[model samples]
Target: MRAAVLTRPGRFEIEERPIPAPGPGEALVRVARVGICGTDLHIFNGHYAAESLPMVPGHEFTGTITALGPGVAGLEVGRRAVVDMNIGCGRCFWCRRNEILNCPEMRQMGITMDGAFAEYMVVPARLVIPAPDDVPFEVLALTEPLACVVRAARKAQVTFGQSVLVIGAGPVGNLHVQLMRTIGAAPVIVTDLSPERVRMALDCGADVGVTDPGGLRQAVLEATDGRGADVVIESVGNRALYAAALGLMRKGGHLAAFGLTGPEDRLALPILDTILNENSVAGSVAGMGQDMHDALTLLVHGRLTTAPFTRAAFPLDEIQQAFDSINDRPGDLKTQIVLGEEDTR
Candidate 1:
């Protein structure tokens, strides 16, 4: 088997590696399509926390089960599946509370273990979800990414008929636009510095897409008759936008901060306004079973197709080209690595 290994920061090379066999409670999956996410880029750039050198760097992938170990009862050989990257310690306090994302010993497959950037990868049985029969490999591969957006939406609690603003128009932000429309059925305002991303946001059902966040805030105020947005989601991880979201949110509204900001990242806010307006902010991490289920349902039923967002594909051997395509083309939404010459199933 061939795998792309991140030997060190700013270095990745495809090399021959031994195929991993399924262990107890694990399954070996023949990779099909792997979605290139910002986290992959962060790991490539050496900014990821748990990502060490010489690791496979992919978490969003759909594939067929080639083999299943003892105790892996549900998934059958040749079953199409998508793996939830996070492996939580079941006995942790956070896991006891059903907050696996906050578990002290959480290990993400792509970050802490070898991931799906190859011909074969091993995954825990509990983390593998059966892909809907009707969903194509391209679409099923998006379930994990969409699940993240669903988690953010769940945290935001978007309400129907309410005004919502999504800050940023990247892949995650674009998903937010679609989910906000589907769940809230309300007009959505999206903002991004990239013109192409703004256009993508509009195509994804944003009522308005602006290239300037401050300008978009003004437009949101005007559209809401000066009341401001009922809900604001910051997806760009920009400190400036984080502070701005607080100001743009209407009284009693909630702000869902989904971006992964650095430890030193901080934003200023009006202390009095937060107290007087009763505004609140919360962070959302990985998805739970329910979020993943909703995301898969949407994909299978054609409600959340990523067709408009998928920009390019490359063979697993050309993984470097895929990453280059993602970085060079600011307009590109999602790039994927096609793992094999033929489909496994």
Candidate 2:
């Protein structure tokens, strides 16, 4: 088996290794596709603190089940699936409360352990969400990020006939636009620095799109009849965008802080306005058990589409190019590594 090993920050080596066999309660997957995102970039560039060097870092992935270990029942080889990457100690307070993402000791697949950035990878069988056989692996690879967006949508309490604004039109933001419309939000709006991305967002069900934030206030005002958005999603991870999102929300709107920011980043809210307007702010991270299930369900039913980012795949040898193209080609909402020839079609 060939694996792209992140031996050090900003470096990778295609190493040959024997196909690993799963142990008890684990499963081996013949990886078909792995999606690259900001998290992967952070890990590669040394921004995100990973457990060790020479780790196989890839979380958002989809593939075919090839083998199962002892006691791994209900999952069979040859089945296609996506994985819920977070693994928490069951005895922790947060895990006990079903908040696995908040567990004191959490080990993610790609972040902390060897993940699906290779021909074969092993994972806990319980975390694998079986997906429909008919769906393409390219599209199925998006299930993880969409799962995180599911968590965000729930945190924001997005509902029918409400105005929602997504402050970014990249991959995750594209999912937000689609999910917002599927939830029946009216006039879903998106703003981004890339005009092409904003246009792509419009095609993904954003009723309104603005390439420049300069004109976004008036657009939001006009769309919502001057009440501002009922929910604002700050998925850009920019402090300026966070501050701007506050001003774009309706009096009682909820702001979903879905983006990642620096540890030291902070913002001063307008105290009087926050109290008088009844606005609320909530932070949401990646998906957990139910969120992954719901995301898979949505994808299976065709309620969401991955048409905008199903292509632009790279092979294991071109891992570095795949990471670099993310910034080079801003309009390419998604970049993935195709692990098998069968999935590339």
Pairs in steric clash, model 1: none
Estimate the overall C-alpha local distance difference test score of candidate 1: 0.82
Where does the lowest 10-residue lDDT sum fall in candidate 1?
336-345
TM-score (C-alpha) between model 2 and the true structure: 0.96
Q: Return the top candidate by lDDT.
A: 2
Q: List model 2 lDDT by residue over 223-271, tens digit each.
A: 9999999999999899988998999999999999988888898877898
- Backbone clash pairs for candidate 2 read none
Error of 2 at 306 (Å): 1.3
TM-score per prediction, in order, is 0.94, 0.96
Per-residue lDDT of candidate 1, residues 97-167 (tens digit): 65787888888877777788889998888878888555678888888889988887777777688888888
- The whole-model lDDT of each prediction reads 0.82, 0.88
